[model samples]
Target: MKDLDTLKYFLGIEVARSASGLFLCQRKYTLDIISEAGLLGAKPVNVPIEQNHKLGLASSPIFSNPLAYQRLVGRLIYLAVTRPDLAYSVHVLSQFMQEPHDEHLEAALRVVRYLKGTPGQGILLRADSDLTLQGWCDSDWAACPTTRRSLMGWLVFLGHSPISWKTKKQTTISRSSAEAEYRSMVAVTCELKWLKGLLLSLGVRHHKTIKLFCDSQSALHIAKNPVFHERTKHIEVDCHFVRDAIKDGLIFPSYIPTKSQLADIFTKALGQRQFEFLLRKLGISDPHAPT
Candidate 1:
C-alpha cells in the first residue's frame, strides 16, 4: 500500500495531532446518535445520570420496543471508545437491553443529552507524558438495586495519558465493602499484568514497579497481610493472587483518599460539580471549549 496522509479519521474517531499531543474525539458519531434519538436542540445536561440513582429491573413500565433501546445502547457502546467519560453511563444502560424499561430509556436519553453539552469532548494524550504505568482502582459496593453485585472500576495510565479503563459488575456477591474492594484489586492486578506483558512485547522499557492506587485501606491490608481469617475466607483465592503479585514486585498497592480517587467516576454517578471535576482529571475535555 502507498503511504497515506496522517490519520484524520478512522472508524468514527476523529484524530487531531499537534505539538502538545493527540486529541481524539467522535463528534460526528455522537451528534448522529443525538439526531437519531430525535434529541436535536435538546437542553444539555451536566451529568449523564442523576447522582446515586439506583436503577432496578422492575422500576417502570416495559418499553414497547426492545429493539430500539438495544440499538441505541449498542451505538453508545461504540461511542465509549473515545468517550471514557461516558463509560459508566453506557455500561449501566446496556444491562437493561435484554428487557428495556421506560425508565432505562429515559436514562439513556439523559446520556445523550449530556453528550449534547460537549460532543467534542474526548481523551487527550499529552506529547510529553512519561512511560511509567499508573493505575487507580475503585469499587461501588452493593450499588445495584437488582443483583446487589458490586461495581469495579479502574483506569491504567501510561504516563499522563490513560490507556485503559473498565467498569464491570462483579461476578460474585461480596460480603463486605472491603471484600468488594479486594475483588476489584484482584481484577486490576490481572489487567496490569496483561498490560505489562503487552508493553514488553512492544519493546517498551517499563521495569519500574507499577503503582496502583486504591481508596480502601482494608483491601490493601488484606492483600499485604498473609494471614487469612474467617472474615476473608470467602475471598481467600483473590487475596492470595494479589499477595503474590505484590510479593513478586509486579505492583505496589497504595492508599488514596476517596475524594482523590479518579476511578470513582466510573463506579457511580456523581453530582454535576464532582462529575466534571473527575472528568477533567481523567483528561477528558471539550476541544471546542474556550481555553
Candidate 2:
C-alpha cells in the first residue's frame, strides 16, 4: 500500500477529506440501490422505520419475486457498512427475507426513502479528538414475536468514532428484562476483552479500565453480587463470564441512564428526535455543510 494524500476509499466506504475533518459516505452505491428498487421518485423520509410500527409476516399475499426482496436486503446490508445507525432496522427487515410480503416491502422502502434524504450521512472521524476506548451495551427483552428472544446491542468507540457495533437477537429466550440485559453485557464484555488484546498486540494499550456501560441497574447489581439464587440459576454459564472477568480486574461495568444509552440505537426503533440525538452521539454527520 502506498501513502496516499487523501482517503479516496477504505473498506468499500468512499472517504472524502476536508479542512475540518474526514467525511465518509457511500452516495453512489446508495443511489444505485434507490434506482434498482425503482424508488428514485419516492418521497424521502426523515426517519427509517416508522416509530411504533410493529412488523411481522404479512397476512396478505407474499411477494412472488423473492429475488427482488433479497436484492433490496443485500443492498441495505451493504449500506450498513457506513451506516451503523441502520443496523437494527436492517437486521429486523432481513428476518423477513425468506417470506417477504407487501408489508415487508413497504418497510424496506421506508428505509430506502430515509437513505434518500440523508445519503451523505456517515461517520466523521475528527483529527483532534482523543482516541479512547469506551463502550455501551443495551438490550430489549422479548422483542421478537416468534421466538420471544431479546435483542442484544453494543457500540464501541475509539474516541468519538464508533468502530464496532452489533444488533443480534439472543439465541436463548430471556425470562426477564434484567436477564436479557445481563446477557448483552456479557457479550459486550467479551468484545471489549478481545479489543484490548488486539490493541495490545499492536502495542496500543489503553492503560485504563475499559468501561462497559449498561442501563439496567438490576443487571449491574447481578454482576457485582456473588451469591446466585434460584431465580438467577437459569442464566447460562457463559453469561457469567463477565462477572468472573470483573473479579479478575479485566473489565468494569458502569451504570448509565437510559436517555444517554448510545447502544439503545441498536436494540430497537426510536422517534426522530431521540434517533437523531443518538446519531449525533455516535459521531455520524451530514457530509454537507451544517445548517
How many residue pairs clash in all the candidates, one count each? Answer: 0, 0
Error of 1 at 89 (Å): 0.9
Clashing pairs in 2: none
For model 1, what is the error of residue 140's alpha carbon versus the real structure, in angstroms, after optimal superposition? 1.0
The global C-alpha lDDT for each of the candidates, from Candidate 1 onward, is 0.90, 0.85
Give the Å error, residue 87, model 1: 1.1
Scored against the true structure, residue 138 in model 2 reaches a CA lDDT of: 98
Q: What TM-score number comes out for model 2?
A: 0.93
- Model 1 per-residue lDDT at 108: 93
Q: Candidate 1's residue-wise lDDT over 42-80, tens digit each?
A: 999999988767666556889999999999999999999
TM-score of each: 0.97, 0.93
User: What value does the lDDT take at residue 176 in candidate 1?
Assistant: 92
In candidate 2, residue 189 scores what lDDT? 82
Writing each residue's lDDT as its tens digit, candidate 2 over 1-291 gives 887776697656888877656767887788888888788888998789977667853576788988898899988998898898899999999998888888888899899999878877888777765656787999999998777999999999877778889999999998899999999988888888888888889888777777789999999988888878976888847547877888777778899999999999999899999999999888888766368
Identify the leading candidate in terms of lDDT.
1
Candidate 1 TM-score, C-alpha based = 0.97
